[model samples]
Target: MNRAAQAVVMFLLGGAVLRITWTDVYLRYVKQGLRPFLIAAGLLLVVAAAMTLVYEVRDIVRHRGHPAHDDGHGHGRSGQLVGWLLLLPALALLAITPPALGADTAARSGSALATVGESETAFSPLPPGDPVKLTLIEYGYRAVFDGGRTLRGRQVQLTGFIATGPDGRPILARIMLACCAADGIPIKIGLRGDVPDLAPDTWVRATGQWIPHTVKDPVNDSEIPYLEVAAWLKIDPPANQYD
Candidate 1:
């Protein structure tokens, strides 16, 4: 495509910066292809801009010597217009710059907001009402590793995703993974009362007491009670999206 078109495309795609910087979606799926993809896109934008400039300059020179061809707009008006159009992409990027994905949203959004390898495993189980500093991944792992024993009737704060149970109850979930968020498996705590009406992708803070539970799963031989949440509040999503 011409320079103006190229510039517009770049602006639209620039939004991908948010995904790359925060979400693991591309890193996990595209893997080695990322660098090449960026390089190619960058090169295309640069070349388009260069062509637009060159054409504009040529038109200026051609019109300068010929009065018969001269319009009020001067030489190379079309090329200059195209060049100005190229600025649209840059302007679009400026207008809609990607917002930072804050780390705080981990509680409300899915485990996709946690940063892989950044998770903490040092969280020792605390007595109810204790101020526990726990990351999303650790909270998820412990809830699973301990088989809900650690969370029995304990007031704990956790950030993660919202998932639905077989009974159609909304659950506060976090996913654990060996790689990226895509591979992350979800674990959830059932929330009591009417949930805060948070949307599927929204991040929020959950402050409540944890109640350990055991439910008979017809599909499984053993009974399991996922963690039960006593109260929850909506808040922003965390900066990262994996762990």
Candidate 2:
């Protein structure tokens, strides 16, 4: 492709990156800590593109009176076509932002139970609250690996999308990302009592007590914990889907 076209592509790609970052859409694919780095990279690309475009315009103006000549390579058409193809990713990002990873991703990966070290087995007493809010990962760890030692006799709240368990029952599930969606692992908790018949990917806030029983995840053979859901309601998906 010509230098002008290359500059345009760079600008589009950079703009796409900036747009997502500005709107907090990047949280779907990456951790919050990477926001600054993404913003910087996007700005760099945009600046470089602008500089290249200015240089190209200056060169064109300087040579406006010269007769055009072409080397017999005849590669311009093919190169332009390839350049157009490269614009699709940028266009997609700008026009059709993809939804965050949800039930389908979680089901395929299976339940991921965090391994508790010997030191981790002795969990601290939970803070006093009628129903303390906890992340799905924390509840899963306490329920399965720690045998609900800290969760017993306590009501806790969890918010996550729903996914079907190995037994085809609804489970509250969240995707835990180490760095990005590509490295996400699903943490699932089986719902024992009065789970509503909701479609997969439906986000919910549930207040439940630990059931103190573990079930085997057929996909990965890891222990899956159960929560006796006392109350639950549908909720909008959070801005950041990953934990």
Compare the candidates by TM-score and give the number of the best one.
2
**lDDT over C-alpha atoms for residue 30 of model 2:** 96
Tens-digit lDDT string for candidate 1 (1-243):
344455454544454433342443344333333545655665665566567667766877887976654446554658757655655654554454443222223233343222334433444666555545455545555654454456555566767656554456555654445543344444445566446566555565675554455343222222223444445667665544344
lDDT of each candidate versus the true structure: 0.50, 0.88
TM-score, prediction 2:
0.92
lDDT of 1: 0.50
Pairs that collide in candidate 2 are none
Worst 10-residue stretch by lDDT in candidate 1? 216-225
For model 1, the stretches where C-alpha displacement exceeds 4 angstroms are 1-129, 147-149, 215-225
The TM-score values for the models, in the order shown, are 0.44, 0.92
